[model samples]
Target: MEKIVIIGGGFAGLNLVKRLDPEKYRISLVDRNNFHCFPPLFYQIASSGLVSANICFPFRREIKKMKNVSYHMGHVKQIDIAAKKVTTSYETLEYDRLIIAAGSTNNYFGMENLAEETFGIKTVAEAAHTRDEILDRLERGAICHDPERRRRLLTFLVVGGGPSGVEIAGAIGEMKKYILSKEYPELKPDDVTVTLIEAAPQLLGAMKKKSRDRAVKDLESLMVNVRLNTGLKSYENKYVTFADGHKEYYETLIWTAGVKGEPIPGLPPETIGRGNRIIVDEYNRVKGYEDSIMAVGDIALMQCEAYPNGHPQMAQPAIQQARNLAKNLNKGEFRHKFEYLDKGSMATIGKNRAVADLKGFSFSGFFAWLTWLFIHLISILGMRNKLSVMVNWFWNYLFYSTSLRLLLRPTRFPLRKHWGD
Candidate 1:
């Protein structure tokens, strides 16, 4: 049996592992974290709609069912293509075949301050941290006697117009509309603000024009300030300067602006393409070593006639590519070319407002919101997670509140005296 090593236990890697024939290949999965986190629901975690465990699954528990698979908790330091070896933080492993699915990281567009200060919802930990920060800021704002300082603490800015940005902005808006008055009685409804800024012409650039229009309308209805063609120039000392030379004071800034592939070291510079993704052929094989080394998911860029710029870095594309690569690897031959199926896009704005574009048809309103909920709930991995998320959603829908709004932090205590003393 051939020894196969896969890096990153993301949507792509997990799907690929499940499809591969375990009896014919011994597989080892490596990741910095020992859990697989669902990125789509990360915003929910950040907004206190869900807990971390609802979307995260332990890798060891998942791999136990596969007799031929083992889990390694470590970060990939380098990949030696010629030697066919993967060097992790813990140890080195030799593989007959290697798969790269390391995924992407937040792109700050060379803005150091934004990268350092802004909150991100890319991982479970980050999302949880963001939630705590938001809650902490609210708590401070409620007690702040100075009007200016309190205003700054109450203002929330989300930079990005994509699904992640829209969803999070909407979630925050919902909290302001429903939860703020009851929980933080000191702060009035008009005192809190949720602003969403998009540098592009419209939000959800990939979606249909109708959907984009609907998203903007829904967000505005929720009292969210939607700014278009607005770019961030700088963020310093709790103040944000826009490209138009205007400045605003805000304590909370959530950045879902962009993401770039985090390619592992030791690959030839020429193999790296736009967005720092490894250039791969249609068969999902690395440029130089098409036979042994393969790249899939967000880390790989395979351009075709339909997608000259490469497939959109999304969950569907990543999952599809992994399944396709697994089939080809199982056959021991790169017989088929990878074809991406565009399954359309959807984004929810608030309680009963959402937009969905399926093929050529577009819809918005409560029905679209229901569709969005159903799809995401079904796509989540693990039955327990699905049920937990469902219960949370149901409870939130009925009460307009959630019990998961918790600001978790480590507790420190003073040293205690010995029992003998």
Candidate 2:
């Protein structure tokens, strides 16, 4: 049995484990967090639509059934490619083969100030923090005397036009229209504002033109301010300066702007490409390291004729690459070149509104929403998580209420400032 060490317990690494034969490979999985977080539904956590536990799964419990698989919880500091050693926070791991599927992190694009001030919803903790900030602002605004301050507290800004940004903007809009007004009667519905800023001319740039237009219209119908041909210049505490030299005031700035690959150290500089992704060959093997190393998920950049750049940094590509690599490893030789099966994409814009581009057929509205719900539900990891999400969806649909809106603030002045201060 080969000693296979997999770094990062994200979608790619975990799927690789499932596809590999334990009898043929002794696996070691390492990640900073002991649990795997479902990224697709992370917006739900930030919006208070679902709790973190509903989407997070513990790795220890998952690997308990696999006899040859071991779990290590730590961050990889460096990978010694020459020695076949991976130096982590805990110990030096030696492996016959190493798989790098460490995934991605928020790309602040060199704006350190904006990165510090803005809230991101990438992890469970980050999502929870954003939710806390939103609820805290609402609570403070309810009794605030200054109208300007109150308005600032109620304003929400999402700084991207991708799926996460669209979903977040829509969720916040629906929350204001449905949840906030009912829960905090002192706060008027008009006081809350949800604005989505996109650097691109259209939202969901990868989708078809009709689908993008449908998403914009749906967001507008839900009372979300969709700003296109606009970009962020700077964020100074409570003020947002746009690239067009316009300024807007908001308390919460959710940074869903972009993401870059989270590459680990030790690989040659040439193996890395734009967006920090590890450049791989047709077989998903790291460039110049065909036998000893491989990469998958958002971190692996395999540029082909169809995608001269690389496949979209998405779950489908990551999982497919992992499976393909596992199959090749099982055959004891690289047998096939990895090909992406483009399985379409969808984005939900509040309750009965969504846009889907499925194999060139674009559609929107209630049917699209249902399709989105079904696909996401089936894509979730565990049975319990799927059930919990379904129950939450039904509950929100029937009553327009979210029970997970607890302000779990860990520090004093979690919002960085107080109302009328």
lDDT tens digits, residues 52-159, model 2?
Answer: 988888999888898799998778889988899999877888999999999999988888787679899987878998988888998899999898889878889999
- Candidate 1 residue-wise lDDT at 88: 86
Q: Positional deviation of 392 in candidate 2, in angstroms?
A: 1.1
Q: Model 1: which ten-residue window has the lowest total lDDT? A: 412-421
lDDT of 2: 0.90
Assess each prediction's global lDDT (C-alpha) against the native. Answer: 0.90, 0.90
TM-score of each: 0.96, 0.96
Q: Which ten residues in a row have the lowest lDDT in candidate 2?
A: 412-421
